[model samples]
Target: MEKIRLGKTGMMVTRLGFGGIPIQRLTEAEAVKVVQRCLDLGVNYIDTANGYTTSEERIGKAVKGRRHDVYIATKTFPGDAEMVEKNLELSLKRLDTDYIDLYQFHSVNDMDTLNRILDPENGLYRIFEKAKKAGKIRHIGITSHQMDAAKAEVKTGKFETIMFPFNFITSEPAKELLPLCREHDMGFIVMKPLAGGMLDNATLCFKYLLQFPDVVSIPGIEKIQEIDEIAAIYEGPHNITSAERKEMKRMTDELGTRFCRRCEYCQPCAQGIPISLIMTFPSFVKRLPPDWYLKGGFIPEAMEKAAECTECGECEEKCPFNLPIREMIKESYSLYEQVKAANTK
Candidate 1:
């Protein structure tokens, strides 16, 4: 595995880091096994979030005796200083570690939220500074789905790293954010590298991302097979073949019209629908087995929520990718309803 310096934080992380989201769906033992496989394959950067249910605990158990061998990064949703402090302490406890390698403000979406978080009096940045000073966390970072917000945060030079979505489908980061990170010597972490599983060719995705030396893509993994597949990429040629380029174009064209990147900009629906999840459920249905889908929490609850979407157009307005969210919700609901009925039968 290839290693690169993670900006000013100074942690040398693997190009292919382990994302802990999918592990939430795995049994503790299963999650541990997958994480161990990642380590065995020389993957050293592990990222999870407090909001990811059991991911932090599973990673904690997985890295118990060998914490020094791996770098752990976890995040908390933006909040007041007290909430941020509380979550940081909880994350330390959950990870069974004295200090976190990198702690992030999770999913910061807008300028207003960013302003509030950077405020000196009650901001989470102060909490993170205090934590770093007290040795609870070594570095502070931020993850955002909004490119504008991420760019602004990067320009401030306050964060050690900035994580955002980057893939064949979403390449806007390449134009500005990528160069900005390099300019500032900030670590650039790529999330949703596979475009939330809408992009079927993992090899092509990895090849595309590997072309950029400064950015690290953390694709969520659950199975040992996923670990093996991703790890094997390091052994072969990293070049994107012409055939692969054609395939990438085909996939991009097919998915460009309707795919939801799960940026969560279209949130707080007036009808109380999880618009991003509902738009994304169809991809999960296609990628996962029926049993895993049932056990993995993609139940009819998503459909029930989708049914509540009143075609209010708020989600569409906020969507940066300009997805037809209302129409996508209808299609996803139809698919979920069919799956629900089949399972009941």
Candidate 2:
């Protein structure tokens, strides 16, 4: 496995790292097995978050005595100094680590949040600096769902790494973000490398991302097969043919531009629906069949059907892209129900 330096964070990580989000779906034993497999395959970078349920605890259990084999990075979702400190403390305790390799400011969406985090008095920088001085964290980075906010952070020349969504579908903004990271000599970690399991062609997507210099794509893994597949991608020469590129463009166009970017901005559903996961059912079902939803028999029962919508419009009001999210959810629910009905019938 080849390693790339994570920007100015002064840590080198494998081109293929283990993402912590999807691990939440796995049992403790399963999660540990997959994470250890990642280490065995030379994947040294692992990212997790305090907000991701029990992901941190799983990583702590997985690494156990072999913590030195991987570079651990986790995010703090603290809004203010007090919360930031507490979040870090909890994350460190959960991960059973004394020092974090890279501590990121998690998912800043707009300039107001950015300004608040950058502020010295009541903001994140104070706590971040305090933590760094205390030797609890070695370097600072930022992750964002918005391209504009990520670009803004890169220009500041303060952060060592910048994580954002990047896939064959959203390669346009990535073209800009990629070069900017290189110019600043910052590590670019790509989340949603598969576009939330929408894009079926993982080989092409991973190959396309590798064309950019100094990028590390961490595909979320739960099953051992996923871990092995990603390991193959890292070990293989990630190159795309001209024909594949043409086909990729055609497929993405057909998939439409409104695919869930996995921004996680459409959260805290008033209905407690796990709206993001539910809304993305179609994409995942199409790409990765025999998924958890299917095995658990939740799709046909637990999901909210499109026709059941009461038009509360809460999701629409919060969407930043002004997406026709209500209509999309309606469309997704209907489509999913139809598929399930057909399969069973």
Candidate 3:
């Protein structure tokens, strides 16, 4: 319901925008219906990516003929100039749009990658400049999970906005990244507003984030109920009551910083390990009934995958949070075994 300028880009968008990840799980018709419902409720910004499988395609289909009603921001995985151009064309076709409002360099997580992409002579940025002039994209932005990469990008002044993981538990961005965004007049778009669905207190989380006027959060949505719930949050008070504060503290204390946010950056695991889902298994068990896993479905299947892990460390290398993913997977598998043993009686 409330709007803010996305920093120097100067594009006005609502505080609660649409995150384009979770909807990839929905069918085209279901995704279209839910996304249209979200727009009808006054949420005007949608962030999608070429890497998110069917996300861009679904959003594109959902917003057909109503492009003027929302801001569509999508990211491309960094690549050579030609590859970058090809990615752009594919995005435009999939999004069914000739021009994009904000195009970001997705997951530029290290200095080497950042430097390579920013190179004027041979880097992919040249193509973005070309696209901007051609009216294919209006603004350039960057998304990163690494603090160093994000800060370097800000100093380059090449990006108009920065999307990063920010939430009550993972609040480190506030100390440096948030201020840098303010200093540079860059838009700070929060990618994991609900800490990748690990935090169940959506009401408190959204209310807490609303306290900062400069920060905009795009929590992934797939259901129409979530759309209506977020709209209600906008209408509700932003202040945290004492009970809510206590609950927030309990959650923060319980989670600390080691848990996964289910970002899926460590995907394509060499052993086909579903690292994010396995990492989130503990949280899932807690949320469900005690015997949910005892029914013997995906948990056993995932545990089989987890047990096959060679500890190749490939997933850890790609993880932005630097989590001990292999160890966590093992722990989850052990928990699964414990439940199985208990159920044998």
The model with the greatest TM-score is 1
| Model 1 bad stretches (over 4 Å) | 262-277, 283-305, 308-322, 335-345
| Consecutive 10-residue window with the lowest summed lDDT within model 2 | 286-295
lDDT of 1 at 179: 93
Could you tell me every candidate's TM-score relative to the true structure?
0.88, 0.81, 0.81
What are the per-residue Cα lDDT tens digits for candidate 2 across 1-345?
888788788787888888888777777888889888888888899999887777899999999998888899999874767788899999999999898998999988778888888776677777888899999999999998777778898998888898888888877555687789889989999988888777767788888888875788888887788889767866787678889989898978776446766455665566655555566777555444434455455454546544555667887677665567777777778777777676676
lDDT of 1 by residue, 1-345 (tens): 899999988889999999988887678999999999999899999999987778899999999899999999999998767777789889999999999999999988788989998887877788889889998899999999877788999998999999999998887889999999989989999998888777868898899998898777899997899879988886679998899999888988888877776667778788888777777787667545556555445455666867767787988989877888888889888888788789879
Candidate 3 segments exceeding 4 Å error: 260-326, 332-345
Residue 163, candidate 2: how far off, in angstroms? Answer: 0.4
For each candidate in the order shown, give its overall lDDT on alpha carbons: 0.86, 0.79, 0.84
Please report how far candidate 2 places residue 294 from its true position, in Å.
16
Inter-residue clash pairs, candidate 2: 7-186, 7-187
Which has the higher lDDT value, candidate number 1 or candidate number 3?
1
lDDT at position 233, candidate 1: 83
Q: Cα deviation in Å at residue 39, candidate 2?
A: 0.5
Local lDDT at 340 for model 1: 73
Candidate maximizing lDDT: 1
